[model samples]
Target: MPEFSRLEPHVVAEILRICETMLDEFDQSYKHSFRLTDVHGFGDFDSAQQLAADYRRKAAGTPESARERMQQFIDALTQLRD
Candidate 1:
């Protein structure tokens, strides 16, 4: 496969667009639900509330951070047009 640097501008733009859409649509939706996930096998919590909070942080943090990073990529890629 060709390296990303070798890809045409349109290809890169389209890839970014598609990725942004996926992040907005699927990723955004799943992230909300991700916070609802159970914290299984991590350890026994002193309370269910603590377990829920821990699960919320672990499950929701990654995708949300990734979404932000993707937005940064999109922004930088867009500036390549300048």
Candidate 2:
């Protein structure tokens, strides 16, 4: 295994923690969208489609951010190996 003299798994853990928060927020939006009121509906359909799109963007960004963090970690490890 490669060595990282100062690297802490906490960096990744923190990233995952933040990602989980994003997912949780997304879940809240997803759940609230099921409401029959003005929030997510114009009676039978979604009126807050723009809100949904925004959350969809948020959802997509979470993993990309996490992936970027993970890649940075990997790059650091690779540099140490080389």
Cα displacement (angstroms), candidate 2, residue 41, comes to 12
TM for candidate 2 is: 0.35
Quantify how close model 2 is to the true structure by its C-alpha RMSD in Å: 10.6
Q: Across residues 4-27, which tens digit of lDDT does each residue of candidate 1 receive?
A: 557788897988787676556654
Q: Looking at model 1, how many pairs of residues clash?
A: 0
Query: Scored by CA lDDT, what does every candidate get?
Result: 0.59, 0.51
Per-residue lDDT of 53 in model 2:
56
**What's each prediction's TM-score?**
0.34, 0.35
Worst 10 residues of 2 by lDDT: 33-42
- Candidate 1 matches the true fold with a TM-score of 0.34
